[model samples]
Target: METAFADYLDEFTRRDWETLDPEAVADPVRVAVVGLGWFAREWALPGIARSAYTEATVVTDVDPDAVETVAAERDVTGVTPEEFRSGAAADAYDAAYVATPNAAHLDYVRAAAAQGKAVLCEKPLEATLDRARRLVAACRDADVRLMVGYRMQTDPAVRRLRDLLRAGVAGDVVHVHATMSQTMLGELGGDTDQWRLDPELSGGCALMDLGVYPLNTTRFVLDEDPVRVSGRTRTRHEAFADVDEHASFRLAFPDGVDALCTVSQNAQHASRLEVTGTEARLISDPAFYEREDRGFAVVRDGTRVDVDFDQVHQIEEEFAYFGHQLLADEPFHPDGEHALADMRALDGIYRSAETGRSVTLDEDAA
Candidate 1:
């Protein structure tokens, strides 16, 4: 049980994945999937199915046929949006996962809060800053737990990286450069007419859909909100004329920490995060993605230590964490307030992009 100095210096990461493991219990949390969209049907539903602390009990959608299809496939109750809005089938599940578009999230969140059910809504909170504030308030007023679905916060590797950084492995992080991009239309078989391309539905294009990964992840790892932000965006394709096809933002944080994050929907796939510090540097390739193999490395004094973490279903980790925390009557990190701050930052980004000026953020954008 004795430890070597080399072992301590080279590889001494603590395990931080207890939430991902299955919990011993007589009953797991029951969940409802609202919005049978592509993400819900193909990604979120599968993630829920794989969760150890939760199980899907009801599937709801605006489209009756899609709801019925997913319900039959998963052997769960199918509730129409109208039915769900009216509080029908409310007893089927203890929590609701709202996967609807940005603007539509409030309705489902309000409805879930009204029924005294816990909620796990997808990130960005809502399409607009005002709506996001109201969404958080709705949950607050009802005294319901509103966990935002930010899966990167639940990644084991990311947590370990955060641990190392916090332990001074990378001393005094000064700057970060992160980028996440993928071809979502014209080349990736993504529907050209999807809601993502619609400015109203998706809020923004590349920034809202993809850029939030870097913004929120950086915020999570640093645990520091940005003091100010500057943003720029580009639109080339007709499908994204009203929104950004490529966007970039520079965030200035406390303690002299700063980050420049970029995202695009027309670029070759890339998800990378590079951190710089006074003593060392850390880099994570394929960082934003959970399904892909991640390459994480720490370099100190011209020496590099690399780790290839085992692939994990990040979506499952998020749901499991939510269910476990909700069952234990504990507060989760990525709750409604946390999401509201992200919305605040995002709103600043948009304002900066439009005004061609750096926007200062409120310290307590509550």
Candidate 2:
């Protein structure tokens, strides 16, 4: 049995959120949400509203009704996608959160950069590798910082996982198993016309939408990029004709570290990740949903230590971090260039699945 140290009992509880005062931000970043989808309306806008460093000032979508409803409900300006792309209501925002479908991300991001606004483009970067490359180049050429919307990176528990791994708390990481799935098809009533089912619009299906959470989160926690990947995909439903329905992939990283990940679009809602190392193991259950109450634990030496981080909202933390970095003129991790690595890896995964072989990212990296 491990003895409980009592010498520092008084210094027990701490609050990280209290340290970063929202009022300390002299100028909060006014944000324009470019997509009026459910994520933008429910998650992005609400997160920005709750953030100390950011405010949602503008909302836009191709659907005027969605724009009107959200803008009116939130008391923000609403514009058509074309108007937003044309830089109308430019003063309303200092940054743009591009939440449009994967294929449409480039146009909006390019427009935002042209308007001298920083970008927080959602994950997968864009629909495909070639377009993702162009998107990153557009931001680079325009000289605006771009950060991909990987909210887990800003989550406290995930950050602590990274810290622990770096401190050798997990010893030498050996293997990781990650699985994430959701009833997205059932939610939308098996709508095949949706962008998620459209390969041209969504890049891939379950892998791109759900599996990327584990894939990217593992990369962030390990601080290592995958050198090679092998994947097998399945399309069991008619809705997944043009895209993957379920996918299982293997990612091989440097230093003998490897991760196996799986995702499904029409299955029971579940997300889990377990990392095993020589000294300790890290586990996260219900890990991928940013809005859910997830649990994390570290187990070793015949003991299990469950972490109880403050239940901070992932999207809100992401907004605050992005805004604070922009205000401080600092660079963003998982920035455009860094995000391209994920894009390349995803592309390689798809290629490997198609060719029924393994794919190495060295050629893409080179």
Candidate 3:
């Protein structure tokens, strides 16, 4: 007895199952999550656990107690950083998620890659362009995947915006303006001695922490790299020591499209982005990276259209996407090359700040 539902299932199986072998199922990719801090436990590990293609096999942290607490809470086992250094913990996983502090990302990523493990590292790949380039080259030499946490790349709204721009819905992009700022409340506030407040450790001030959002977003949406950058920074608060608490930058793309970005640690909560083109404009409220109650409004010829999006857990989506790529042997986008580009841009920003002039990217430098 032939049935309509049977045919539907058969069609799906025929098209999608061509590359899948029923008898050759592979084991889930084993993942070791580094750092048991706020982000790792509450977000990354949980997200990895929720992913269908990867298993959270282990966790590691420098603080033994913190690691043990998270392992108990998440029902997963972990090793202390000392144990990991001894190579006892390194053999237990096939991949790692490096969620350590900004300063620690380089060393941790190197160690994981040396151990023949694919690495998913948190953003700002490293504190400097030199370090970022070295890490990318090292990963390439090791023949392992190195992915940076540009999680906004997986946001549906961001994806849609990229699609619109690529599809020429907005015509030629002429300008981009983005802002990501919030009061440095609670732990986000530097206590005169916090690592993030230290220029040496944090790489920069609010720009490195929050400003990366706009920088990365503009690049992603425009699908172009900045050829020149000019910027100014000011230390509004004494808490940041030598680091600037507020800063702004103007990035000029190859086609004369300019991107204006601002980031601060002392402003009231506000994150907004707008892309103005020859035909229309796309504006997003709140953070482009956040998955809270947010939407994008398009304006053209005095007509406005607002599109609401479902709340999505970006961490979950990011982890799931990484896991799926691993399982399917697909290449991961925004890999080390992407991180190197952002770091290069950041290098330009710092140069602009130091000299108070626009700095151009040296293509060969990256």
| Candidate 2: tens digits of C-alpha lDDT, residues 1-366 | 122222111122222333456677767899999888878877888899888889889989888999899988999999988788888878889999999999999999999999999999999899988899889999999999999998988877777667667777778899999999888866656555689888889988988998789899999999999999999899878868888999999999998899999999988988898889898898888688975787888899889877665577778888988888888777788798888888888888888999999999974562
- The TM-score that candidate 3 achieves is 0.89
Regarding lDDT, does 1 or 2 come out ahead? 2
As for lDDT, the candidate ahead, 2 or 3, is: 2
lDDT digits (tens) for residues 246-309 of candidate 1: 9999999998799999999998989999888887887888798755777788788898878754
Best by lDDT: 2
Better of 2 and 3 by TM-score: 2
Worst 10 residues of 1 by lDDT: 1-10
lDDT of 2 at 217: 95
Clashing pairs in 3: none
Candidate 3 lDDT by residue in tens digits, 262-326: 99888877788899999888787765434355567778778887765465677876876777677
Clashes of 1: 0
Q: Which residues of candidate 3, in runs, are more than 4 Å off?
A: 1-26, 187-193, 289-291
Report lDDT (Cα) of residue 154, candidate 1: 85
Root-mean-square deviation (CA) per prediction: 2.7, 2.9, 6.1
